[model samples]
Target: MLANSSIDNAASQAKTMFGEELIWLFIFGDLCTFTLFFFIFGHARTNNSVLYHASQAKLNVHFGSINTLLLLSSSWFVVRAASAARKGLIQKCTRALAGAFILGAGFAVFKIIEYIDKANAGISFSTNDFFLFYYLLTGLHFIHLLTGLSLIAYFIYNFRANGITRQNHATFESGAIFWHMVDLLWIVIFPLLYLLP
Candidate 1:
C-alpha cells in the first residue's frame, strides 16, 4: 500500500509529461497498427511452429541485444535532452541531443550489418514466411528510427538557431515523445523476434 501511494505521487507529479495531443494520437494509431502486425506474425508462427523456430534460430541474438541497448541508451539521452531543455540549459541539451543521435544512428548501422550478413548467407525475405515477417517488421521499424533521428537533428537545428526558448520547448518534447515511441516499439519487437521461444 505504501509503494502504491509513492507510485501515485510520482504519477501525479508528472501530470505535464505529455506534449502535444496530436502526437499522442498519432502514436496511438501507429501502435494499433503494430499490434495488428504482431498479431498476424503470432498467428502465422502458431500455424508453423517448426519453421518459425528454425528461422528464428537463424537470427543473431547478440546483434539484437546490442541494438536494444543502443536504443535504450539513445532514449536516455533524449530524456536528458528534454530535461535540460526544460531547465533552459542549451549546452547540455545540445550535447544530449548529439548523444541521442549517435546512439540511434548506431542501431541503424548494426541493423544494416545484420542484414548484410544475412544476405551473405543467402537469406532473403522470399526465403520463407518467417523471413518475410522479419524483414517487414524490422524494415518498418527502421523507417520509424530514421524518422526519430531526423527529429533529433531538427531539434538540434532549432537549438543552434534559437538557443532553447519556451516557444520551441513543446516541439522538442513532441519529438522526444515520438523517439520514445520508436524505442518502445523496438523493445517489444526485439523480444518478440530475438528471444521468444
Candidate 2:
C-alpha cells in the first residue's frame, strides 16, 4: 500500500509540473506575438508620423481612461478573490470574483459605445495604420478580458453548484492569473495607443 501511494503521488507531481510548463509556454507565445505586432506598429508609426499623431488626436481619452480604470479595479478584485479562495473564504471569494466579472463586462460595454461613437465620427480600422493597430490591439485585449471573465463566471457557477472545496483553489488561481494578464496587456496597450506621442 505504501509503495502504491508513493507511486501515485509521484505521478500527480509530474502531471502538475507538466501543466505549469504548458501554461508558461502559452504565456511566452502570447508575449512574443504581441511584441512582434508592437514592433510592426512602431515602425509604421515612425514612418508615418503625421498620420499617427492625427489619429491619436481623434481618440477619446475620457473613454479610454474609464476603461483603464475599470480593468485596473477588476484586477484588484480578482487578486483578492484568489487570495480569499486560497485562505478558504468561499463567500468572500465568490463576491470578489463576481465583482471582477461585472466590471469586465462594464468595460466591454463602454468599449462598444466608444467604438460606435468613433465610427459615427468617421473613424474606423481602415482609417490608417495607427487607427488599425489601435482597433486591433484594443479589440484583442477586450477578447482576453471577456475570456477571463467567462472563466471566472464559470468557476463561480461550478463552485456554487458543487459547493466550494479545496479543489476550487486551482480554478480561482487560474482565473486570477488570466485576469492579471489581461490587465497587464492593457497597461502596455493604453500608453502605446492612447498616451504615447
Candidate 3:
C-alpha cells in the first residue's frame, strides 16, 4: 500500500510538469507563426518594391510611435499591478489596473486614427502586401489588446466587490503575462513594419 501511494504521487508530479511544459510549447508555437511571417516578408522585399517605405510615408508615424509608448508604459503598470496583487494590496492593484486599462484604450484610439488616416490616403488592407500584413497582424493584436482590457476590467470589478484572493491574484498575473506578450509582439512588429528599409 505504501509503495502504491508513492508511485501515485510520483506519477502525479510528472503529469503536472508535463502539463506546464505543454503550455510553454503551445506559446512557442504561436511565436513561431509570427517569426515565420516576418521571415517570409523579409525575403519577399524587392529593390524596386520600396513600395513598403512609400506606403509607410502614408502612415502617421507620430501616432504609431505614441501608441508604442502607451503600450510600453502600460506594461509597467501591469507589472506593478501584478506586484500589488501578490502582496495583497487591493487599492494599489485597482489603481494600477485602471492606469493600464486607460493606456490600452489610448493605444486603441491611436490605432483607429491610424486606420482612418491610411484609408483617407487610399492605403488599406487591399492596397498591397505590406498593408495586408500590417492590417492582419495589427488587427489581430488589436483584438488581443481588447481582450486584455476586458480581463483587467473584470479583475477590477471582482476585486472591488469581493477583495483579493488567491484566484484573483492568479487571474491578474495571467492577464499581465498576456498583456506583456501583446506589448512585446508590437516591439517586433513596429521595427519590421515601420523602421526597416
Candidate 3 per-residue C-alpha lDDT over 1-197 given as tens digits, one digit per residue, 9 for 90 to 100: 11344345434644564223444564577689888888877776554367777876666668878989999999999889877765567799889999999999999999998888778878779988889878988887898889889988998898888777544454455567778878988998887787776
RMSD of each: 6.7, 4.9, 6.8
**What are the per-residue Cα lDDT tens digits for candidate 2 across 19-104?**
23455666678788888988998899899999899989988888889999999999999878766655556688779888998999
Please give the ranking of all candidate structures by TM-score, highest first, separated by commas.
Answer: 1, 2, 3
> Which of candidates 1 and 3 is the stronger one according to TM-score?
1
lDDT of each: 0.88, 0.78, 0.77
lDDT (Cα, 0-100) at 86 in candidate 3: 57
- Residue 113 alpha-carbon offset, candidate 2, angstroms: 0.6
lDDT score at residue 80, model 1, on the 0-100 scale: 96
Q: Residue 184 deviation, candidate 2, in Å?
A: 0.5
Per model, state how many residue pairs clash: 0, 0, 0
Query: What is the clash tally of candidate 1?
Result: 0
Tell me model 3's lDDT, rounded to 2 decimals. Answer: 0.77
Better of 1 and 2 by TM-score: 1
Q: Point out the worst 10-residue segment of candidate 2 by lDDT.
A: 1-10
TM-score of each: 0.90, 0.87, 0.84
